[model samples]
Target chain A: MSEKLATAPRGKVSLFGVLRSESIRFFSLNSTRILILLAIVLYAAIAAIGTWGIGSLRASMGGMEQMPGMEDLAAPGFASELMGSGLVFSQLILGVLGVLLFSGEFTTGSAVSTFLASPQRLRVLAAKTILITVVTAGVQIVSSLLAFAISKPIADNYQMDLDFGSDAFQRVLWYGALAVAMAALIGLALGMMLRNSAGGITSLAALFFVLPIILSILTSITDWAQHIAKFTPDQLGMALATPSSVVTDLESWQQLLGVAGWIVLPLALGAVLLAKRDIK
Target chain B: MIQAQQLTKKYGGKTVVDNASFTVQQGMVTGFLGPNGAGKSTTMRMIVGLAAPTSGEVLVNGRDFKKSRHPLTEVGTLLEAKSVHKSLTPLAHLRAMAATAGLPVSRVHEVLEVTGLSSVQRKKVGGFSLGMGQRLGIATALLGDPQVLILDEPVNGLDPEGVAWVRNLARQQAAEGKTVFISSHLMSEMAQTADHLIVIGRGRIMADAPISEFIDNGLDQTIVRSADIEVLMNALNGDGVQLRRIDEHGVEVTGPDSVTIGRRALEYGVVLSELRPLQRTLEDAYMELTRDAVEYHSSNVAETGGGK
Candidate 1:
């Protein structure tokens, strides 16, 4: 028994060890795997469906040629460009997954075990943040590539030009991943703040779904509200991922700044709270 | 060993654990006996650094647990049963915890076997019974094979077998010169398991001594029975001996052992019907110590106030 005990290493809880433990626990759950798979499948499926529908519409409008902006809409192989069409839905799904990662710990009373293993509370939080960000980013990228592959032939059938190397496509890939990452971080923050699954997810939904709709309505009535709506996470993520042909007054840098702000503010607040509050 | 120096915890303006101090030495199973709301859990949490003390400090192995780098190897705590994710199997949870201390995965299986959780190692903890959950909790605590073990209500939901297993485990761990600090509201269980007893009541230390000392501190009493009970009562009457009539045939006497009572009765030529020494149990000692310290006084108004 003493020799068996001698094999157990003592002292100094390393961040790397904590991160590994957190990652294993995060992935071992069925819910986490299901959420990631659902996000990926939904992202790819929505992209393929959107491509087929848009391809048909473009073909039909080509013969008429009377609709305003018809020529602008007739980009060759627009179907391929639709590969990232489901970025919003993907972000929402993975965002909820992110919320559950931390919030579930508290809801199920696992936070005690987690913190006890690594008493440096911030190290555990950091481990969780890195694990979720990496996993979410990986899922988003894989879904985008799969959607592109499936949508390419359909775009070719409609004679739409789909250039993977184009600046717009690259922006869609990079900014799209960033958008999902931001949503996940925000979800992680909300999880730490609320520390309840239903409460955190509900609050996340209100931020992404209800708040944007209310802001859109308010923007229509008041000119000043438009600026506020532009800064919303949903709007920043959408503008960054899918640049519309219709130009707006804000520069590309300003839209990127909006995305950066959305990611930074909430995450900073959440980190502070995570460090300060007692693990329940 | 665990040492707490003037440990205090305040929630808002209410002081849950006052400036209390005690030391738990190694090589002994120290029982933390306290009534509910006596701050036993809070003090334990503070010692493990889960709850920060408002002032003062608790040191495990001569240093604060918060400052210790390898806490799991220093102190193993089973704060509560099922403090794990329901979705995770006991194997995954234990493996993850072991990974933190750089312990091999084999330790996980070893602890599972020891705790009798090998059969349910793959089952989700959400579906586990209370006894199984307690076993899992103990397994996780033993994963690090730490020197000090702190368990709170470890046998709350165990069957007779589990209770016996825990008793043997505690004694075995202490026999190995490891510190075993266990808290339980069950006096009978503590009486059987603990070598040294620390009794807490209403957020204050009531008695901190050996189990034998605790039993000895309470008053000694003897029960006597006689057909001529009135005569025996009269014979036993003295400045030192006090007697209470339990019924028509029996008298409960305090301040005199049964030998003294029997000798007195025999000298008086009174026929001895029954003379027995009534040994005070640990429960009696605990109740006598904590009777005034019970925090929540539920009114028995429904029973006592009803009209006969």
Candidate 2:
């Protein structure tokens, strides 16, 4: 019996090992695969639809910018911006993925096995952070690339400029990934702090969608509302990813800082709470 | 080995585990016996660093488990059944856990085979029965082959065969010089499995001793039945011995073994019909020890039934 004990070589816990563990479980779930595929397919489909809509509109209004408030859609670079038309949905969808990644541990009581295997609470957090970051960012990048591939031919049919080398399209491809990754990280943090899937995803939705409308209403009434509204996660993500669609005069660095704040603050607070509170 | 020094835990204003202090030595099966809501689970959680101590400390193998370099190899724990995600199959769950500690994939299969879960390794845990979930939990605990094993209510949902298997597993692990700590509310189960018993009640350590000492702590009670009961009572009555008439021809003698009483009856020329000594069962002793410490007291059904 003694010899049968530990027939395999015993190994220690490491950051890389935990990362591997996180990825193994992450990919094994049906929900994760559904969300990733949904994010990519939905993003590309929306982008193609947007491109066709803009192309037909431009063709119908031949030789003249006759429509008021439609000038942005008629612009040459708008086709590139069309590729990122599904950025908001990507954020929410992948954001829910992030929320489930951490919240599932608590909801299913798997945190017991996870932490027992690697007792340092912060290490588990780090591994989860790394996993969500790579997966969400990678998914967003792929989605953006697929959206571009699907939208480019539609733009060419309308003779619109859909240059892959264009600065606006580049921003949509790269910063768009950053924006989705930010939303996903925030979702991960909310999941850790709330420890409930419904509450975390609802809070994430309220942050990304509902809060902006409420803040817009408040901005009409007060000067301070304008300041806070611009820093909302949804607006910051849009302003960084597709600057042509939103009107914002803030410096690029300030918007990046805002994005950084969204990513870092909640996760840091979650780490502190995770270390201080018991795994109940 | 695990050493808990003045370990205490409180939730809100209610104290859960209050001032528990004990040591679980290697090469023995230590039974943490307590009634429901007696802080047995909380203490086990604390031992593995799942729950932080409110004021005191618990050391696993001479240091905090949180700081251990190889956590899986240091302490493998089963906090409760069904701790794995429902959507995950046992194979995926075990693989994920093994990946965390860099253990070989073969170890996962070994545990699955050991726990008789090979047949359903690919099935989602959500579809597993309670007993199967328990087996998976045990399999997870044994995955790391840790020096210390902490199982909380390991036999809660097991069949009789599984229960005996767990008993043998605990004994074999202890025999192999590994520290085995198991928590159960059943004294009868512990009587058959544990060499050392640590009884807890209402978050307090009630008794910690060898299994033999726990059973032998009570005074001897012997039943003596005779045709000449009055003669036996008068002759057997002495200091430190109390006699009670149980029936028309029987007297219960306390503080003397049946052998002593039989000799005394012979000396007094008493014709005895019965000279039986009642054995103190672990269940009775446990009930006696935790009479005041039980969290919930059930009302007498006879009294309650009258109202119904």
**Whose TM-score is greatest here?**
2
Q: Is the docking of candidate 2 incorrect, acceptable, medium or high quality?
A: medium
**Each candidate: what lDDT?**
0.84, 0.92
Query: How much does each candidate deviate at the interface, measured as C-alpha RMSD after superposition?
Result: 3.1, 2.4
Q: After superposition, how far is residue A140 of candidate 2 from its true place, in Å?
A: 0.7
Query: Per model, how many backbone clashes are there?
Result: 7, 0
- Alpha carbon deviation, residue A174, candidate 1 (Å): 1.4
* Model 2 regions lying over 4 Å from their true place: A1-6, A66-69, B266-269, B306-308
- For residues B1-308, could you state the per-residue lDDT of candidate 2 as single tens digits? 99999999999999999999999999999999999999999999999888999989999889999999888888878888899999999999999999998999999999998999998999999999889999999999999888999999999889998999999999999998999999999999999999999999999999999999987989999999999999989887889999999999998899989999899888989989999999999999999999999999888989789674
